[model samples]
Target chain A: MGTEIRVQQDDFSVADEYQQLAQESSCGAVVTFAGLVRELAEGQLDAMTLEHYPGMTEQVLADLVAQARGRWQLGQVTLIHRVGRLALNDQIVFVGVAAPHRKAAFEAAMFIMDFLKTQAPFWKQEHTTDGSYWVAAKDTDQAAATAWQDD
Target chain B: MVKVKFFAALRERLQCAELDIDSQPSDSVAEIRHRLLQQHPSWRRELLDNDVLCAKNFTFVDLQAAVNPGDELAFFPPVTGG
Candidate 1:
């Protein structure tokens, strides 16, 4: 199993992290994804605040990385989520996975974000020109998490 | 009993965090929500919105689920997280 964990306020470089994760020769493919803040959220957003549970948020993220490792084999897994007041164009999250082949690397990265969207205790607060809104968890996210039960 | 928390606009309306809900035999997500409004008038405000959101044990929830003793439940507006 391969995994790396860190919580930082600054953005992370996926290309650099991927290099470290897929370093071993046996590793054939490295898949990495970055989530960036967008101008519009749910169709309305002048500004947004991302809230996370202090201790709980990190624990949940680390656990998710471990779970992904249990499902795949190769080199490393990396997840970086930024907290505090963030504006548009800021990097929000990073997920990188290493595997012996391409498929595991690709799928595991996607799966982790899908699960994290609902499972993790992170909240989003949006501020539009007219008003501000908080991003609550959605049922669709829970259903996505449920599908992972079979996998 | 379980402790439920609120955040963002929902929290603003409820005006607090960590709601202590006593256990009931048939206590459910919807049931608890109904009773919670009885406790605080403001809790009912968000529901008027078409797409308010909720979660059970930190994950989003649907109508089919119920809350039991020691289960963490949550309520908030629709998620805008990317």
Candidate 2:
């Protein structure tokens, strides 16, 4: 019955987030996803810097969470995204969902993530040994977001 | 005047993060972009790119979307996030 959305420069703990979602006694399932920064195969990597539009980012995330709730019987949901420079292997984002059934938790988590990819106002810049460049949006992400429209 | 903002690589390319532009009630997002280019002729290339995205008052809008004074407009490339 609660939703937590955070856009921060600080790292978040997956375990703590899971514990928070598990607090809902009525929920039997909890699903969580954590995204990380990975090294590039082409060259040595430095770090990934994340940028976001302050006011718009939180609002968009809340809206996505609301949409997920509307579509599913969710109990508690938590979404946290980190901004600023992140080293390789650093946790970048986290999504956790609790529901009475596994299906709703899984689907709601995926739906929030899918929509967030294309709709959220965050951007990533990859810093490599050679130079830093903005990561391009993938067509696959657009397709993933669009696929949900048919559901 | 409307506040305009640029984010990520677009900000670096344009070397401008934010700007204030004079606008009329009838102005559309496209027209505001046109006015920006009129002020900074060098920004034409980046601003005119078809891939560039614009949002008015924190909501995504098409070029034809109407705008007004006191509104906040953001222009940037497609978002890449999880």
Candidate 3:
């Protein structure tokens, strides 16, 4: 199994990521998830700035990938998280998992996403005409992460 | 010395990204946090937020985690990333 993780400001090409992931023909299943920004709640937003601990962000992401590898029979996993300024509807993050079966690929992809929410060291600040404020971490996210412990 | 880092809203509130403090080998994350509060009492409210999270050497750690010289310690609000 292999893993790739990147934290950057530039946008990523989902098509290219998919094409590359599909090249491993031996892996019969590939699961991918992309998180996008929304313009809801506070009305139109100017932009969202994602701040992160440079070293820790990458470290934690790699650790998450390692954890996924341990839990499932993963072939290749790619995780990309965007930082810096982002407009509404912009892609925020991606988690892709490849495995020999759908169950492992699906479960591992979900696990990576679940842990990424509460464990990763990234923060979001939404900018609107009212003013910019840090987005609070939701209790539901913690619950989702915690639920995985029972698995 | 221990390198301390702050992130997210906590970073903005404290107006600090990083700092260095002389620390003892037996110092725990909580002890360092206490010392920081003593030095910058103004930051108490933000730093002491109930949901504030901590990490040592890029890994999530409890307050009781011991810190050695040259270790990296970080403080921040709970993560909001997806």
Candidate 4:
């Protein structure tokens, strides 16, 4: 019922987004995270190229948002993930959630991001000093996926 | 009938990431994957590994779903976007 659960690639303004999400009467707190493209990953990242399975990218994000919503009584959610080539320090992704309380908002946002890191169908090739290589799925990322295990 | 293509890690192993899949009248994502494996068994490592991703005309898909004969089908490794 809230203006939440959005996934897109276009530039977004976080300050404006926070103002909008916090305007609601039922929301007491809003939590947001802005992810930037780091210049290094395992000490090799000069620049990176991000590629995604177009249709599955948003679908997976939407699914993760839904999972977060199911776990917490969140009011609204906003997730923006950017694609294409990005330089160091560029904004890569954002996750913001609003709930009646900060706890739910914060946990849900973190949960969503954790799942996105591993589950979402977006891939990147890191430009490095030694040589460029595809970013492999990390053990931490796989372990994070266990959090949402419904079993 | 869109042309299907693969990139990055998927292409590195397969050497070629694209092919003209002459669509069957009632092709599903599963069938295309099987055919690709038939032609290139190394693809078997990536496809059934549970960490791979598949796309039909640039969109990810469930293997059981239907596909157009004239359409393209692509298989690749799971994504690792930040």
Q: lDDT of all the models against the reference?
A: 0.73, 0.94, 0.90, 0.75
lDDT of 1 by residue, B1-82 (tens): 8677776666777678777877686777777777777777765667545566667775567755878888887666544443
Write candidate 4's Cα lDDT for B1-82 as tens digits.
Answer: 4355776787777788667655677878777777777877877876676766676655567888788756766677766765
Ranking by DockQ: 3, 2, 4, 1
**After superposing candidate 2, which stretches have Cα over 4 Å from the reference?**
none
- CAPRI category for model 1: acceptable
Model 4: lDDT to the true structure: 0.75
Which residue pairs of candidate 3 clash? Answer: none
TM-score of each: 0.70, 0.98, 0.97, 0.79
True contacts kept of each: 0.29, 0.80, 0.92, 0.57
lDDT of 4 at A132: 77
Tell me the DockQ of each model, to 2 decimals.
0.25, 0.88, 0.91, 0.49
Residue pairs in collision within model 4: A5-A77, A123-B80, B23-B69, B24-B69
Let me know the TM-score candidate 4 reaches against the reference structure: 0.79
Pairing residues by index, what is the TM-score of model 1? 0.70
Give the chain B TM-score achieved by candidate 4.
0.78
Kindly report which residue pairs in candidate 2 clash with one another. Answer: A1-A75
Candidate 3 local lDDT, A1-151, one digit each (tens): 5688999999998888887777787899999899999996748688999998888899999998898888888888999999999999999999888899999999999989989999999999999988898998999998988998998
In model 3, state the lDDT of residue A35: 95
Candidate 3: global Cα-lDDT?
Answer: 0.90
Candidate 2 similarity to native, TM-score? 0.98
- Per-residue alpha-carbon lDDT of candidate 1 for residues A31-97, written as tens digits (9 for 90 to 100): 8888887887456556557766555566777778777777866467888887766877788888888
RMSD of each: 4.5, 0.8, 1.0, 3.5
